[model samples]
Target: MKRRTLLRATGGAVLGGSVGLAGCLDQFSDSESGDTDSHDFPADYETETFDGQTVPFAPLEDVAEWWENDEARFVDARTQVQYDEAHIEGAVFSPSPDGLESADPVAEWDTDTRIVTYCVCPIAQAGQRAATLLDNGYTDVYGLADGFNPWRENGYPVESNDGQASLSTYEIEGETDPADAGEYALAVHPETGQREASRIDADGGYELSLHFVDVPDSSLLELRTPSYELEGTIEEFSSATVQV
Candidate 1:
């Protein structure tokens, strides 16, 4: 969706750059920052809670097919780095469960269609994504279990959103080291501008499991990047899988 498609969308280049460049740039936010929406979720994991709450996950295939023809909403639940690597087609980059009501917040929705959400893999984060939609009165809310991995695993279409906020990825880095696996988890969504992730997995593992959730989950939500080595467990859950 390029602004150039609109006749009045662009004027001529101004002294600085162009008349269309200054006031119209922010007119492009399309996530769910402050509205109501809904969709369907995959079926897999169960709902659990410790710090906040971790919901079960849904199958990726079932979810993709569900919205393949339907005009359902889509969201990415991973950090910016992970999302930049790859994401489902036509999905916005709002890590928040609700998409709207977020720091960066999605700014648009059809409302009539259902809204679906996902994260690196979709289990607890999907629940978090649903919470936002439900709270905003969106009845048709859901998560895409097995997130991007499943989509790519089956040779489904995926894209890279370098900087489209609405369809951009997040960056889940930590200022400090993370606890053992299964003990606690933290994540960040760069697309939505929600610096702190609340909804997480609390019962997937135990302290013996490195004070984190499952090994995969821990790795996904622990660090923001590999080269920098941000502070966190960086578990590699099926939901939030990273290529590198």
Candidate 2:
């Protein structure tokens, strides 16, 4: 199946020099923010909340300029199959959870290099990866605010394979022991380490949307948290009354 094509059609906020727990760049407007005639890269872009963190956001326009001038490296934070289907022209696939570990290309880049992370679900996975990078000392990182769809839709540069299956969202929802509240629930693809994570809420509930290309109901996944790990097939996850 091709991607579901459910795109978010909303404008996003701009970027700042530093990231905080939560805040937004004032929504850009010529009338409100005075003259809007600056081309400064990060300032020109917007901000958005993704994956429970405030990350810098770059819209397509700023990203296009960065692409042409070689100002930033792009990272695809989706699954390998999603990357193989279609991605920005030169994005490297380094799906979250293990994005920059071991042999990932981004690991070799200088800590100060400008990096941008993106995923089709707007910015959740991308923001998670970008947040990881920033926490580990990357100087400049941003999540693609509108994600890959806008770039592809507007006919920007991309690399793609023919006849590949598009992505679909696989959801896993459950409640854990109340003691586990404030921890995380992660769904990990056993093979690729592609993952989705959500914080266990105060009531011990969590839900995750794992995006993949051509996932079978019998495919293995690891549902994990700090205290326990449960392994099961996608079909099993759908029915399991997991309480740990």
Candidate 3:
């Protein structure tokens, strides 16, 4: 049997200028922001009609029950790093955007398998992922109504790499030196060969606070810009950092 690999974001196109520094940092928040409140689902949340099919939202309790019974598959619709830092136990990593096309882990699941997609966003990414799965012939797909935050808040089971309960933050400070550096990606590499990247703000000075699962001190970090790419291990980064 061929082992499946999670899809990775590649090229400058993956960064796409849509996410800003602040928005990226917000993913590590312990609680959901105000924007999430409006989209929170009640116990009596209504199902929506999509593509002539009635799609339902899976309440947190329902998801918890299914998880406890191992009756449903949980898909994380955030970035791989986010998934690694902390995720519901047994949930699969399937980041949004390129994930549906590149990192589709459920491509071989039975059509009747109960699948639940969840994200920290305002019901946008998770809902889209669930809809896409439904469009692709999945019979029983549902989006987690309030996503992982609420589940975590309710003292549910979550697993983290490196034994940390939450993601570890690292402040990456460097100088691109070149004034014309437009945009760049800072990638964190764990020993397991998974790469998590975020767009770095290039204006003024170059500084970004990155989050990661338990990255061993021996893991590698890379900085990629339009003109150049530099790679080094975390040990070197701690002392010298990435200097372009």
Candidate 4:
């Protein structure tokens, strides 16, 4: 949807005071500063509203500079399986859009911190969480524009937060691992340590996927190919066989 809301600053001299308001996100406490000055902040704040939440959304190219900064925190809004399969560097799994809005994960963060939320989609569930922060009085909130795809495409680091997921390769609640034998078949990625959930076999080629479900609803999946990582919503075991 085309956003019509104008993210203007009223309580301050200007909406955005400076280019480096990012520092304010890192160092200033939400209580330390009220919504008094929009100066030193991203100028004329504008955000794309998703799911009734207005998050600071910016293009991948625009916020690329933030990747190297230490003050930024990237939150993965996708499911645990997806996160275990792939995710951006320094990202934490909050699953805010999935109904964890008032959860402790967000509580761990100070209201004054600058958090960049993301998800798997053309748009993101993080938009809602970003808006939540703003509504709670957070001055700085941003949603990574292209979501996780841009980060991976840009060659940034990705990892599986498998530890945070409820399921693991060691124990398949339902479907059996069709990739390898024994423990290796149903095990975490040796390198990423993410649990392997599903595999793909197509025309003599095969791939694997680790679906993350605990993530916020603002995310989607980017299967690597004939292989996939499908998120299972039910407790019963589900299975699918693809012919190679």
TM-score of each: 0.47, 0.61, 0.49, 0.47
Weakest 10 consecutive residues, lDDT, candidate 1? 17-26
Q: For residues 1-244, could you state the per-residue lDDT of candidate 3 as single tens digits?
A: 2121223323434333222112322222221222222233454753543222344577788889999999999888766667767788988876643254554788768988898887652444465466566766777788777567788879999987535434555666665534323343445463544333332343413444545556654566665444345666655555554554
lDDT of 1 by residue, 43-146 (tens): 43333321232233345566777667765667775445446656777777765443434564444564445766775432445546656556555666565654
lDDT of 2 by residue, 132-174 (tens): 7766777778877766777888998999764667656676777
Which one wins on lDDT?
A: 2
**How many angstroms is residue 157 displaced in model 1 relative to the true structure, after the best TM-score fit?**
1.3
Tens digit per residue, CA lDDT, model 4, 66-173: 767676677766545565656777777766443254564766778677777776433324554565566767666687765666677778777664555542211222
Two-way lDDT contest, 3 vs 4, winner: 3
lDDT of model 3 at position 71: 94
What overall lDDT goes with each candidate model? 0.40, 0.63, 0.56, 0.43
Which of the two candidates, 1 or 3, achieves a greater TM-score against the reference?
Answer: 3
Which runs in model 4 stand beyond 4 Å of their true positions? 1-46, 51-53, 98-103, 162-244
Give the better candidate number (2 or 4) by TM-score.
2
Candidate 4 vs. true structure, TM-score: 0.47
Name the runs in model 3 displaced over 4 angstroms.
1-44, 48-54, 97-103, 162-244
Judging by lDDT, tell me the better candidate of 1 and 2: 2
